[model samples]
Target: MKIIILGAGQVGGTLAENLVGEKNEITVVDCDTSCLRELQDRFDLQVVEGYGSHPDVLEKAGAEDADMLIAVTSSDEINMTACQVAYSLFHTPTKIARIRSPNYLKYKEKLFQSQDVPVDYLIAPEQLVTNYIRRLVECPGALQVMEFADGKASLVAVKAYYGGSLVGHALSTLREHMPHIDTRVAAIFRRGRPIRPQGTTIIEADDEVFFIADTKHIRTVMSELQRLEKTYQKIIIVGGGNVGLGLAQALEKSHPSVKLIERNPQRAEYVASELAKATVFCGDASDQELLSEENVEQTDLFIAVTDDDEANIMSAMLAKRMGAAKVMVLIQRGAYVDLVQGGDIDIAISPQQATISSLLTHVRRGDIVNVYSLRRGAAEAIEAIAHGDSSTSKVVGRMISEIKLPPGTTIGAVVRGEEVLIAHDDTRIEQDDHVILFLVDKKYITDVERLFEPSPFFFF
Candidate 1:
C-alpha cells in the first residue's frame, strides 16, 4: 500500500516504523526539517518538507497515488484541512485524521462527512488514552484491559502472584477451580519471553498472563492467576492536560474521591470550573511536600500523565515510594516503558501505542472491527467479522480446531449477536460471528487476515 502521513510527530513516526516493516510505501510530510531527517534516518520512507495542509505539499508527497492519507499534525485544524485537501485534490480513497478537540467531535456528522471535510476516520489519541486508563481503573488488578466483540468479551493481562490458588499449577487447573466459568489462557510471558500456553503449562509467580473471557467473568478468571485487589478509590491524577482533564471528567461521575493536580494555575482553575465533583489543586506534581500534604500515602491509585516524560516518571516513582497502592505513568519512549514497567510502576501507558491501534483498525484488511497492540507491539489482538458460507470462507462453518490458524495465534472468543462464547475445539464459527484472536508473533498478521477473507473465486 502507498500511503502519505502528515506530521512526523510521535504517532506518525511510530506508524511509519510499523507500516514500513509490512512493506508499505510510506511518505511523511512535516514542517520540521529536523523531524523529517530523523524519520528518514530511522525508516525506509520518503519525507517531504512543507506544511501538511497545503495543496503543494500533498502533491510533493505523492498524495495523488497514495492509497491512504493520515493527518496527525499537532494542530487539529491542520489535520482536518489536510484530509480535506487530500480528498479534494488527490481523491485519496481513505482519509484518517487525529482530532483532539471534543468541541469538533460533538458535530462529527457536520465536520467529517465526505461532502465536507471528507475524513473517513477520526482518531482521538487523548480520548483513547483516557478510555484505556479508565478500563485499568475499573479492573484494578489488570495490567491491561481491552474489550472485544463489542463489550461482550474482553482480553485481560494480569500478573500471577505467589499466593494465588493456581499460580503454581498447570493451566488446566483453572477449569477445576471454576468449572462453571468459560475462559481461555491465551498467552503467558515469563521474564519477558513468550511461552506458548497449553493445558499442562504451569504458571509461575510473576508471570504475565493474558486471558479471554466474558466481560462479567473477567474478574473471576483473573482471581485464578492473581489475588484480586481491593476496588480502587481516592484516585489522584497528575497534570491537567488533555488526557488528565478528560480522565478527571470521566471519573467524576463514575468514581467519587477523585483529585486532579496541575502546576499551571490557569489550567487548574479551568479544570476546576468544568468538574462538578472532583477536587482540583494548583501545585507541582513533583513536589513531595504537596503530595504528602494531599495524603498521597493513602491514595489508592496515582496516575502521572504530564507531558514531560522525566516528570511523569519521577512523580510516579515518588508515588510508589510513598506507599500508593498502584502507580501508572504515561511515557512515550519504548525503552523507558520497558525499563520502568513491571518494576515499581504498575503500568506504563504509551500514547503512541494507543494511537497506533486506532490507526491500524483502518489500515488492516478484511472486515476487522478492532485492533489492539499488546506487549509493546510484539503481539496483537484483533476482532474480525466472519462472512460467507462453507465454500466461500475458510473460517465460517468450520469448527475452531479445523480452522488453519497460524502458529502462535489463538482464537480466544467469538461473539454472535448478543452472546459471547469462549472459543473451544468443538465450537463452530458461523457467518457474521465476531472472532477475537490473539497473535503472540505479529509477523503472522497477514496469514490471519487471509484466513478471514472470503475466497475470490466464489460469487455472491
Candidate 2:
C-alpha cells in the first residue's frame, strides 16, 4: 500500500513507525527538515520537507497514486485542504485528516464529501482523548476502555485486586461468580509480560486483565476482578486547550462539580462561557495555593492535560499529594507514559495512541471497523465483521475453537445485531457478526485481518 503522511510531528511520526514495517509504502511530508531527517534515520520510508498541504508537496510525496493520504499536520486548515487537494487533484482513494477543531465537525456530514472537503475519515485526537478519559471516569477501576460494535460491547482493562471474587481463582470460575452476566477474559498481563488467558489460568493480584462484554455488563464483570470504585463526582482539569475544554464539556453534565484551571485568562473565559456546569478559573495549575483554593482534597479525579509534559506531571503529582483520590496525566512523550503510570498518576494516556488507533482502523484491510492499541502497541483489540459463508470465509460459519487464530490471540466477544455474546469454544460465528478479538502479540494482526477477508468469490 502506498501511503502519504502529511506531517512529521509526533502523531505522524508514530503512525509512520507503526506502518513502515507492516508491508506498506510510507512517505512523509513536512516543513521541518530536522523532523524529516529524524524520521528518515529511524525508519525505512521516504520523507519530503515542504508545506504539507501544498500541491507540489503532495505530488512529491506520491499523492498521485497513493493508496491513502493521512493529513495530520497541526493546522486544521492545512489538514483539511490537503485532503481536498488529494481528492480533487490526485484522486487518492482514502483521505484521512486530523481535524482538532470541533467547529468544522459540527457540519462534518454535510461538508466532508466527495464534492466538498473529500475527507474519507476525520481523526479528531482531542475528541478521541476526551472520550477515552470520559470512559475511564465512567467505568471506575478500568485502566482503559474501548467501545466496539457501536457501543454494544466494550473491551475493558482492569488490574486484579486481592479481594475480588476472581482474583485468585481460575479463569473458568468467572461464570460461577456472575452466573447471569456473560463476559470473556480476553488477555492478561503480569509484570509487563503478556499471558494468554486459559481456563486454568489464575488471575494474580496486580495482574492487568483485559475483558470484553456487553457495555451494560462491563461493570458487573469488572466487579469480579476488582472492587468497583464509587462514581466520580468532583473533577479537576488543568489546561484550557482543546482536550481539556472538550473533556470538561463532555463530563460537566454528568459530573456537575467539574472545575478547570487554565493559565491563559482568555481561554479560561472561553471555557467558562462554553460550559454551563463546569467552573473555569485562570491560574497556574502547578501552584499549590491555586490547587488548595479549588479544594483539591475533595476532588474525585485530577487530570492534567497541559501541552507541557513536565507541567502536567508536576500538577497531577501535586494534586495526588494533596489527596485527590485519583490522578490522570496526559503525557505527550511516549516514554513518559510508561514512567508515570502506577505511581503518582493513576493513569497515563497519549493522544497520539488514540489518533494512531483511529487511523489504523481505517488503514487496516478486510472488515475491521475498529482497532485499539494496548500496552503501547504490543497488543491489540480488534472489532471486525465476518463476511461471506462457510466456503467463502475462514471465520464465518466456524466455532470459536475451530478458527485457526494466531497464537496468543483470543476471541473475546461477538456482537450480533443488538445482542452481545461472550466468545466460547462452542460459539459459532455467522456472517455479519461483529467479532471482537484480542491479540497479545500485534504481529498476528495481519493473520487476523486475513482470516476475516472474504474470498475472491464473495463481496460485501
Query: Which residue pairs clash in candidate 2?
Result: none
TM-score of each: 0.96, 0.96
Off-target runs (Cα >4 Å) in candidate 1 are 456-460
CA lDDT for candidate 2: 0.90
Clashes of 2: 0
Window of ten residues with lowest summed lDDT in model 1: 451-460
Q: Mind sharing the TM-score for model 1?
A: 0.96
Model 2 agreement with the true structure over 1-460: per-residue lDDT tens digits: 9999989999999899888877899999998999999999999999998987889988988888899999999999999999888888898999999988788988989988888788889988888898998999898889999999889999999999889989889999988888888888888899999887889999999999998888998888888888889999999999999899989988988986999999998888988999988899999998999899889999999999989999999999999999999999998999889998999889998988998999999999998999998888778889999998998898888898888999888898999999999888999999999999898888777888889998867432
Per-residue C-alpha lDDT of model 1 across residues 1-460, encoded as one tens digit per residue: 8999999988898888778877689999998999999999988999999999999989999988899999999999999999988888889999999999888988987878999888999999889999999999999899999998768899999999999999889988889999999999899999989999999999999999999999999888888888889888899999999899999999889876999999999999999998989999999888999999999999999999988999999998998899888999999887789888878988999989999998999998889989998877889999999998998999989999898899999999999999999899999999999999999988888888888889857532
